[model samples]
Target: SAWLGALAYGIMKLFGPITGLFVMRFNNRAALMLGCFLCSVSTLVSSFIVSMEVLYVTYSVMYGIGASLVINCVMVLANSYFDKHLGFATGLVCSGSSIGALVLAPLSHFIIQTFGWRMAFRFFSATFVCVGFLNCCVKPIKRKRKGDYEQDKNNTIENEMSFEAKVSKRPSLFRNRAFILWVIGTAFGMFGYLVPFVHLVSYGVTNGIPVSKCTYFVMVLSGATTIGRLVSGRIVQKGYLNSLHFIQLCMIVIGVLFMILPTITSFAGLLPFIAFLGLVDGCYVVLLPMVTCSLVDYNDAILAWGMLAGTCSLSVTIGPPAAGALFDIYGNYNIAFHAAGAPVICGALILFFIPW
Candidate 1:
């Protein structure tokens, strides 16, 4: 089950760059509609699957591709619509994922238990169709035409120079120092980002916490994450701190929290740690696109995001299993937690040294 989940996640991230190309070739609305169609059809087909192999094809690959397209399009559109208040707008948009997880988790559980897993998937299919309808509400941004630039005779030379510079520097996206640091730092941070989410409950159980109470840790984390997303966005919008600096601080805090997580033996002690980690994690997530926008040209934001996602895929895929392997060797989660914290801290330090 863990391997399957990882495969699904990995596949989704692997297709991030492709999704970017799709958006660039077509348009946001088309990409979104296509994503919605893929997701709806994949889920509907998954409902009738009888074999694990078929499940992988329908649930992992197809569903993952659809999800990647949807996510990238949303980020690109959010960036396009709001510039001045981009942070808050991104937070508002990304928070929906956490909200959906909170709402659908139990609802899906109820449906699966009451009816069956097939019914649960069918419900998901219907939900995606509803989401497709909502996608139609977003108007596509009108691209500027070459003739439009010709009408501005006074700034024609300047516009031409700017366009030439952009074309010439297009390849610099991969070579830019700031972007390189950002990607490295983000990759390291992501390496261990999902460790706690995957292992926290099991860790609590091993420490003798009641299974029922341990489950609430995730809920608490999710709720705190929602608050963190909103608060972080507001902070960025208000210009209280640089978004990159804020992201670095969040990474450091999360790293420290993970390192100290194993020291807490009781359920009550773990709640505060989980909540704070989730809060910082949430801040990091929403700031991703905001910071990506700052680091690259507006035209390249989506592609940069896609590149970042693809680069982090390996780290995210192996992080949890690596932690699990450590547990197998050490007979406890202490080393695993420490291992998780190390990369995040290193990633923060890498960011701290960014020239910009």
Candidate 2:
């Protein structure tokens, strides 16, 4: 399962940009629906895997296509739904992902223990089918009048100017200097960021921690992320300057959390870390809106967001494996924590210099 997931994730990065760019240019609604279909299909296929290699091929590779498709379209859909409350709306939308993690992580355990892993896969596939059907209900917003169309075009012009001015002033980013740096730093940062959460149970097992007790860490993290989404959204809405800077600040906290994570010896100690990580994770979602707003116009928000997510997904694609590889080499994840802090720090510094 692990290998299959990794294989899927690794290649998904390669295809993400193409899929995202194509969706932005062409029929976005169809693209969005297609993603949902892929997710549903991937889930259905997973139930039939007979070997680890098959698991990797279907769940990892095919499901990756579904995840990538969903993410690209969802960003565009989010932009359409929220104009005044972009940050809050994005936070609300992203909260579902963390909520799913919190609920499904436990539910999967129960299903696997009682029925079988295959049944668990089938259940997830069924859930995606329902979600896809719901997405089909989202009709394209029709411009009813010539005046409305003109107004929309004007809004697009204004937003484009706002973004162009920002980007024009920063030749480094346009020349691809800062963008390249940002991508590299973020990618490296991701490598170490997820290790603690993914390996928390194993770490506990190695320390003779009970399975039940160790599972609580996952719950704590998910709960923290859920709460964090709302809290960070509120904060972003209330504030005015430098959302990217705020993101950097939150990333710093995330880095510190990982750095100190190994010191936690009991559930109580772990609780704060889990919650803090979740809160910071939540802020990252809210930051997407702020970042998009900062870099592009309100009118082109959907396309800009698609590009942003496609770029950042690359970082996510690399982060976990880098952390895993570090563990393999060093026999401890301490170095990984330190490594995760670097990209965030660099990202912070880069945004600090840019005109927000």
Candidate with best TM-score? 1
The global Cα lDDT (0 to 1) of model 1 is 0.85
Q: How far is candidate 2 from the true structure (C-alpha RMSD, Å)?
A: 5.2
Per-residue C-alpha lDDT of model 1 across residues 1-356, encoded as one tens digit per residue: 55656787898788888887677666788888888989999999999989888889888888888888898778757787786777888998888888888888778889999999899989999999999999898788855533556656844554556544644646757887899899999998888878978999999999999888987887888888998898899999999999989998988898888889989989888998888888888898898888887898776778788888888999999999999999999999999999999899889999976777
Clashes of 1: 0
Q: Which stretches of candidate 1 lie over 4 Å from their true place?
A: 143-169
Q: Candidate 2 on 23-108: residue-level lDDT in tens? A: 64454566667777877788788888687767776778778877767765665465665556767777787788789888888789
lDDT of 2: 0.67
For candidate 2, the 10 contiguous residues with the lowest summed lDDT are: 169-178
Clashes of each: 0, 6
